[model samples]
Each structure stands twice: as C-alpha cells, then as structure tokens.
Target: DHHLNPCYVCNSTGHNCRALPRMRPRIPDDVSPTEITGNGLSETEPPVLEEEMEEPIGVEDTDFVLYVSAVETERCRRGLTVAYASHCQQESALDRPVAGHANFCPGELSTKYRDLPSVLSTVKHEMLHALGFSVSLFAFYRDDNGEPLTERRPDTGNPPLDEELQIHKWSSRVVKNITRKNWMIRGGFMERTFHMIVTPRVVKEVRNHFNCSTLEGAELEDQGGDGTALTHWEKRVFENEAMTGTHTQNSVFSRISFAMM
Candidate 1:
C-alpha cells in the first residue's frame, strides 16, 4: 500500500539517510535517560519512551518528526482523515537511501477548527503522532534502502498496563525485531501494534469520565473496522486524545508524545 507516496520521513530529514548529521538535537538534560533494571530487558525495546506512567501531554521533537498522509493509510485511505506520522529509520549516519513511511486516513478538515489555537492544537496532535506516540505504524519505518530499521536493545523501564495493552513491556520478539516489509499484521502484533503508549487511563477516562464506549475491559480498540487494527487508540480513550482514531473537541496533545521524537 506504500510506494513512493507523499512521504514526510524523507522530507523532514532532508534525505539525511545517506549522511545523518552528527549534531542532531540531544535529549534535553531535564529528561532522564531510560534506566535499566533486572526486568526482561532485550534489544528490541520500542523506539519511543516517555514517562514510566501516563502519556504526558504536548511534548514534541520537531527536528526528526513531521506529518504526511496523502496515501494508503490503514483507515479511511481516501477519506477526510487529517494526517499520518511518517519518518525514516536509518541504521546509522551512513546508510543507503532507505525511507520508512507512515500515513493516516485522508480527510477534508473543517473550517471551524482553523483558528490558531485549534490549528496549532491539531498540528501538535499530528506531530506527536509522527513522533510515534500511541501509534502502531512505527513497525514500517525503514532505512533509505527499503530495509526495516534496527530496534533498540535492552527493553527496560516502561510502565505496565493490562495484557492487551502492555505499553511498558513487549509481548513478543517479532514486534520487537521484525518489520512490516511485505505485510501489515506480522509477528503477533509486536510490529503491527504500538507497544509503547498505553490507554488504560485514557480508556477509563473515556468510559467513566467522558462516557465514550459501552464495552467494558481494556480492549484498546473495538472489534475492527476501517483499518483500526493498530493505528489508533480506542476511540473513547482519554476522551479524544490527539492520537485517537477520531478527533473531537476534547483533543489534548500529550507530553509523553514529545519524548518519543
């Protein structure tokens, strides 16, 4: 479904895959590097890591992160979807011209939300999505040579959620190491699913606080429709988080989102 689409990964990085600058922005000193413990750590840790708990609101790294979704995203391929998170995952500063692409459903945005606050808010939401917040398409990020990017090692220091949504811990090796080269649902959902962001709190907030869904339990998304497999949070989680499948008045950008970029 992804072939020479309007990809943002290369645009944002300026085709840096051939030679990524050594002086990319460093992680801010205020944010601590992820700590390792005796937990079942491995080299397949997720690309994005935020706080131990909670999907913090409104954090972003604009350098390597950007937006583009004018293509075959999982949901509403040619619909009014706004944008998708897309970026390259080069193996190192000196790799071939490989580019990984991520896209969201296409949609005609409404004029009502075009004001500065609303526009910027929406951009914040999409930017975080590009950074891999609560997003599952990270499995497709590839190097310039069309090969899957390498995953970091020693999975460690993530907060825990229910079995269905274990954001902190990877459930399998495939999701951790495998790439979606030819297919989407590959390797027990480790690649097809987002194992970094958990929506338990958001789900609860939606179910209890915002009155979103009727179904109970920690099923992040409903049965499955319109490419809902691993691209979005349960529609009701956190009552319209920026990364949810649907957008609403309650949308709020997450802080944990910023760290992932």
Candidate 2:
C-alpha cells in the first residue's frame, strides 16, 4: 500500500479511519465537461441500474451507502467515500481529439498497482493508518509520573519461563505524560524513546504478536519524506508488513497491524 499520497481523510495524520464518517464532497453543480471517446461505445448488454439499497443494518449510522455499480472496469468506480461524481458533458464533447485527452487515463493506479487484490490490500493498509495504527496516541500511553502506560514488568526484568512473559504485558488502564520522555527526545538515553509515539497498547500488541521484548521507533533511522519518518511501522523489523512507511509488493495487513487499527 505504499501510496505516497497521504490519507484523503484526516490529511495523512492517520487517525480515526473506521470511526470517522467519510466526508461527502461538497460537490459543486458546475462540473467541467467530460470528453468521451471510442471507449464510450454502448456495451452488448446494457448496464444494470443501481438497486435501491437499504441503509446499512444494525451498524453505526456512519457506514456508507454503497451503490453497487455493475461496471466491467475499475475506472468507472469511486473511492471509499462512495460519492457519485457525475461528469457533465457540454456540446461537442465528442468532437475533441482523443489523442491528447488526459481524462481518458484518469487513474491513481496503473501497471503492477492495477492488481485488484493488491489495490484492496493497499486500501486496507491506508485505512489502518487513518484509524491511528501509529500516530500521536503516544501521549495517551504515559502516566503523570512519565512512566510507560504498562504496569511494572513484575520484577522489572525477565521471567523464568517463556510462558511467564504474558504477565509482563500492559494492564487494562491507560495513561500518559507528554511533558517528559516524548517523541521530541531523539538522542542519548531517549533515542529509542521515539518508539513510544505509537501508544504502548499498539507496541504491546506488536511485541506480543512477534514474541519479541524489544520494540523500537520509526522505520527509517535516517531522515525521510513527509510520508515517512514518524508515520510507519519499523520497516526493518516488519518487512512487507502493511503499515510500514514504504508499502511492499503484495503486502498483507499483519495481525498486529489489524489489532492496532
């Protein structure tokens, strides 16, 4: 899901995906004319009209009304918001030369990205980030005394048996203090502390899934672009894991990623 573009909702801040109702575009009545070409030829079978869908049953009202479009191609489809983008056509829309027409190629994904499953996985990955898989929730995971949100790790060290490690996990309670040991301290004793930015709950989920005690910071140790650095799963540790800054080919959302989302 290595989409360079940030989340359309929340503007790549990556919090509140599933909880956030998608913004229905304030569609303006004045639409630019749509140019059609040979591709608009009538199909052998006429298109199936949309069935009147019932409002989603038993879920929160936020669930969108998905108008199932019976199209043979992805180009005619809409994004997650389910907004209908009716393109208006003015006079002589067909007279324009198809050679220089850019609208014919209007797509965000092409080439290897055109694989439907891969595209869907990438959408899942982005949606996870939008729902706060890794974001500013770090502040919520610290106590007033500036300790991590977890209870004391029993003896402040390892347990005798591997089975005993489960006791070391986080308690149901959550607290945080941003005044000290926050994402700002990037060097010295606090260098690794950057990892705390993703709430300990998520870190705990990640650690438990991998059976690893040590969890660390942003995927890129070096500086990164707007979409990288603080906003991803550790790439080195979770290669091909969907939440990492750079999406891998054929990546699937890992269990830890799903839980955090």
Candidate 3:
C-alpha cells in the first residue's frame, strides 16, 4: 500500500467535466459604525435621510462585499494552479488551530459555503492541501524553565536555541509557498502523523551532524573559498537538556509538540 499512497491530486476529473467555479473573496465596504437593526425600511423615511446618509445608499443596498476568489476559481477551472497569495488565510489558521476533517467535508460544503468568507477560506485551504503545503505540525520553542521564546520580540535580549525552531522556520516557509492556497487543517492526529514522520529525521540530524559546541571557535572561511563553519553550542545544549525531558514518548514529535511554546 505504500506505493498506493494517494495524494490529494488523485481526484482530478477529466475533459468532460465542468470545473468548480471559484467563490469571491470577502471584502468590506464603508458602512456606518452604527449597525442597522431595521428589518425593512419605509419608503417615506428614505428620501429625507438620503442627504444625511452615505452616498450610493439604497433600500436593498448592502455594505458587505466579496472579492478575490472569483479570480482563483477561474484559474482552477482552467487547470492553472496559482501559488502563494500573500494575503491568504494561512496565518489566521495557524493562530487558531482546528480539527480539519471533522469540520470540513464535501457534503458540508453547501451549508458552509453559504457564508461567502468561509467559502473562500475553505477553498483556499483545500487547495493548499492538494498542493502539499499544508502544515502537519507547528510549534515554537521554550527556555529551560519551560517559557515560550518570543520570536516576534527579539529585543528582549537573547533567546533559547533549539533545533526545532530552525527546522520549523525553514520548513514553514517552504511549505507555505508550495501551495497556491492557504492551509486550514490544524491540531489533529493527521498533524501528529506528519510530525512523527519528519521530526525524527530532524532530531537525528541535529544530534549527529550539527555541531553547536564548536560553532563559536570554528573560524569563518572566505566567501569564495571553502569557509569554515561556526561552532554552535546551542545545538549540543538542545540535545542534552532539551531532548532528555521526562516524557512517555521520547520521539521528536512528542518533544516538539509538548514543548512549552
């Protein structure tokens, strides 16, 4: 079954099939901060308030809007895969992890897609998966006392070093760009499965090959010449102190996920 492992691309419908139309991207319009509570407006009241209300006003006019996805859906229909919409919802999904499959299925699409914003996000998420850029596991690092390091605020002196941070930083960017859409799947056994598969390799590489102890003393070589690599003590510390924590599962996946991020 290893050879039979199905990727997301297996579901391509051929020539006779019609493509799924892309949904619109949600947009906002100029609306007063005061929300309208009226179920219906009177014909008599509208004319007098027209001068006071915002221009382009009408009885049925809405301030809500839908934008970008129409363009993407068209591209999908034409069999063109676009990668990396910078404004995509991948970051948002990372902030709020969810159970992917349980909440999302083709059958539930009808109800979910009724909400324009959700529809666009949902489509973009699936497209990311189809392209193989979805995040399987995401985590940051912590200090010796189990406090999460602030990657954002580097101004707070120095930060703890862990191989996971390096791998996560490198892999996250590569994975994000690999897809034309954004990733939405979060915190599930699927995420854990992916972590289990790749993390051990990362751990092994950090443990055996990357030398942190000699990083500082290792002289840097000329750019054109074969440069000497710097000694990195953090790598050794990570292996000895970070990796040896008391956990039932000593696997890299367990360590990283359970790290005090």
Candidate 4:
C-alpha cells in the first residue's frame, strides 16, 4: 500500500498553493515592538508576548508538537540535557548554533529550523561535528609519539573505505532514532563532510573516497571578495565541469557558509 507524506509546502492541502512552507517564527523572548519591514527598515517595536518557553521541535508545522514530544522523550532516555534560546530571529538565523553542550541558548533546544527534516538533519550533522569528525576534529589525531597523524593525506592510495566505515559506525546511533513521520536520513558521514567543507584536499579526498563531486569547486568562482586569497584557473576549470548541468553558479556561497557555520 502507498502512504502519502505531507507536501513540504502547504502540508499536503491539495489545493493551497504556496511558494514555501509556513514556518513558525522563533522570535526572541525579549522582543520589543520594533517592526522591521521587508526593505529592512525598522518602524515600531514588536509587542511582547507572554508565554512559557517552548521546546525545539521539527520544522514541519503540523508535526511540530509531536516531534517535540518525541524529542523530549528521547532526550530523557539518553540523559541528554536541553536548554532554550530566545535571541534567534529570522534575520539572524545563520548566526546561531542550533544546539550545543553547555551554552545552549533559550529556545534553541526547542526551536525548529526552516523545516523539520532539514533541522533534524542539521542537528545530526552538528552532533557528528561535536563528536569529532569534521575539519575541527581532524586536529585531534596523534601518532604514538604525539605527532599529528591526520595531517598527512589519508590512504586514498587504497581508498579510505575503512575510515569511512568507521565514521559511519560512530554516527549511526544518534542518527537512527529520530522518526520524522516521513523523512529518513541517508548517505554516510563522508558524504556530509564533502558537502560541509570546500578545500582541494577535501575535494580530492571525497572524489577518491566516495567517487563523487560536490559544490566546493563552485566556491572558487568568487575570487575578488578577499584581497589576499587566490584561486587557480585549473581548479576553476574543474569547478565548471563539475557543475556543467546544474543550476545557477552562486551556490558556492551557500556551501562555504554552511561549513563556516
């Protein structure tokens, strides 16, 4: 039998056509009545709403409450502590860290991001980074004599399948538990690593490790922004080839920002 998942936008109304899904605003707890217009001009202050702090749930609005309840239960079961942040406004969405170990902001623990699936995926993604896997974590590896071992190129000489498998094993449990009612996570951590960073080494590593290409090359297109950084045309040629049949070329900004975040 075929089961239907709610459409990303309009919650599968079958008639209500909207450009994007209706997202709940994660307004700051200390909001005043300053109205910010579409043109980004401020007018009057926003009225303060008196409500208890809420938990972060998945972004799909209809399922938000349910997802929150499940998340609370899971957190309880895992003995994970949660906190909230009220300062996360839409305009500053990119500035906040979704959740973290000790310094979690108010509402952050409970604030659903743009969409439920994407936010949950991001949670898992960030958790992996926290557990030590991303570029930040690569600095942790040491040789028997206390020298950095991960600084050298991984043995793509024989393909780093074993290392990739190890990373998958480490992240699988935290990723497996969240039920989205529809969304399911796929792809290994290696794939996520490739998408999250832009570097020649990461590009080559991903290509040799997973036999795939990513948007890292596209970021090379923006050269004049920073005065000192320079990109060579050889990599630019590869970037163009990687994105031959894809959409617009400005996506590198998005990919680079993702890693930086």
Residues 50-158 of candidate 2: C-alpha lDDT, one tens digit per residue: 3332332332343222122323345424332211111111112221111110121124443474676755655555454434342333212344355545443343221
lDDT of 4 by residue, 1-261 (tens): 011112224333223444432233344545543554543324454433343333334344331111112233333333232321111111112212222231232233545553444334334433433333233222233333544333332432111223432321212211112222433346522211111223334445435444466433312222322211121112333342211111123222222223222
TM-score of each: 0.37, 0.37, 0.19, 0.21
Candidate 2 weakest lDDT stretch, 10 residues: 95-104
Candidate 1 lDDT by residue in tens digits, 1-261 = 122222223343123333222221233344334532233223344233332322223223323423355554455444555554433432243322234444543354435645546555656665554455433444333343544443433331112223454222333321222233344344643333332232334334435543457523222444344434455555644456555666667567543233223
RMSD (CA, Å), candidate 3 to true, equals 21.2
lDDT of 3 by residue, 20-71 (tens): 3222222224333243235323333331121111232222443212122323
Report the Cα lDDT for residue 180, model 3.
16
List runs of model 4 lying over 4 Å from the truth.
1-104, 108-114, 134-136, 142-147, 150-204, 208-261
Q: Clash totals for all models, in order?
A: 32, 2, 10, 20
Report the Cα lDDT for candidate 3: 0.27
- Where in model 2 is the C-alpha error above 4 Å? 1-60, 63-108, 111-114, 134-194, 197-200, 214-223
- TM-score, ranked from best to worst: 2, 1, 4, 3
The total of clashing pairs for model 3 equals 10
Error of 2 at 183 (Å): 20
The global C-alpha lDDT for each of the candidates, from Candidate 1 onward, is: 0.40, 0.38, 0.27, 0.29
State candidate 4's TM-score.
0.21
